[model samples]
Target: MALFKRLAERQRPVLEFTLDGEPASGLLGDTLLTAVLTSGAHLRGSDFSAEPRAGFCLMGACQDCWVRLGDGRRVRACATALEAGQHVLREPGRRP
Candidate 1:
């Protein structure tokens, strides 16, 4: 069972991107966290136990959803928009 659903049948534009060198896609208006989670990708791993971590606060207050770009720049996934052709890397056990 899904926790949420769209009120109406509406399709948004799809955007393509790469996650850890693999191809992935998501809706254009989605945040990076939504994109990755929708695609069944793990956002990152916890620093203490190296457990897979996803969004916590969803509002950027908690740093659990932080992800890194291919160039090693980090961004809060929940607050960042998904861009076409964007490349995101998942580094396990990385601190925010």
Candidate 2:
């Protein structure tokens, strides 16, 4: 169950990646957040609440879209571009 769906087909090439160790792919220019949500993956769970967060502001100012890359770097998903072979993961124990 994806949270989003593309409105129309585009010619951009798809880049392969992984989300939580599961195979996934995204359009070449997609932001990490866009890739994650559109794949039916949930954003990180809120630290203060029981609800899951889907990034309050699409921009990078909210500090709400942090996610870990496979290389162990934490990044703001909303501001990061999805790249080929990139691996994204929800911070451990933060599952919604």
Candidate 3:
């Protein structure tokens, strides 16, 4: 079917990234949280309300995908790329 073919064509090859300081490798097309959570490692982002977070919406619409970058900037993990050496942190302070 045309739809199936189109979907298949849109799928990109999996790229790898290191989560926190741990070695977490997964598809690049998937959001960073999705990759990290799928690997079964602890994450610190908006994906969860508890510690060691996870990914919720794969799209950028949800604010729960937030993360602090290596440069100390907070960004939505769902909207950012999973760079090979990126060090993303969860919101450090108490949730307001």
Candidate 4:
């Protein structure tokens, strides 16, 4: 189950990745925020509210779309590019 459905630009090359240990794919040149939301079930749950967050600003300004990389580094999904074979965890500080 995906969050946001892709309505346009469906012709780009697909890039494969993992979301919380689950295999997922997204279009090339997509942002991590868009990739995960459209390919996975949902974004990371909020720490403050324990509810799902899609992202507030949709840019790099807000601190809402943070995700953990395989190396344990934190990055904003909204500003980060979707990389091929990326291991993304919804929980911050979680290593792949």
For residues 1-96, write the lDDT of model 3, one tens digit per residue: 010112242366666655565565556566566555666544452333355445456687857667777688887777776776676565533442
Order of the predicted models by TM-score, top scorer first: 4, 2, 1, 3
Best by lDDT: 4
Ranked by lDDT, the better of candidates 1 and 4 is 4
For each candidate, the alpha-carbon lDDT, in order, equals 0.80, 0.84, 0.57, 0.87
Residue 4's lDDT within candidate 3 is: 11
Residue-level lDDT tens digits of model 1 in 18-94: 98898887787888887788676467888777787777889989888888988789999999999999998876885
Q: How accurate is candidate 3 locally (lDDT)?
A: 0.57
- Candidate ranking (lDDT, best to worst): 4, 2, 1, 3
Which structure among the candidates has the greatest TM-score? Answer: 4
Q: What is the number of backbone collisions in each predicted candidate, taken in the order shown?
A: 0, 0, 1, 0
TM-score preference between candidates 3 and 4, better one: 4
What is the Cα-based lDDT of residue 81 in candidate 1? 94
Q: How many backbone clashes does candidate 1 have?
A: 0
RMSD (Å) of each candidate, 1 decimal: 3.5, 2.2, 7.3, 3.7
Task: Flag the better candidate by TM-score, 2 or 4.
Answer: 4
Error of 1 at 38 (Å): 0.5
Candidate 4: stretches off by over 4 Å: 92-96
Write down the TM-score of every candidate.
Answer: 0.84, 0.88, 0.58, 0.89
- In candidate 2 the C-alpha lDDT for residue 68 amounts to 95
- Screening candidate 1 with a backbone cut-off below 3 angstroms (N, C-alpha, C), the clashing residue pairs are none
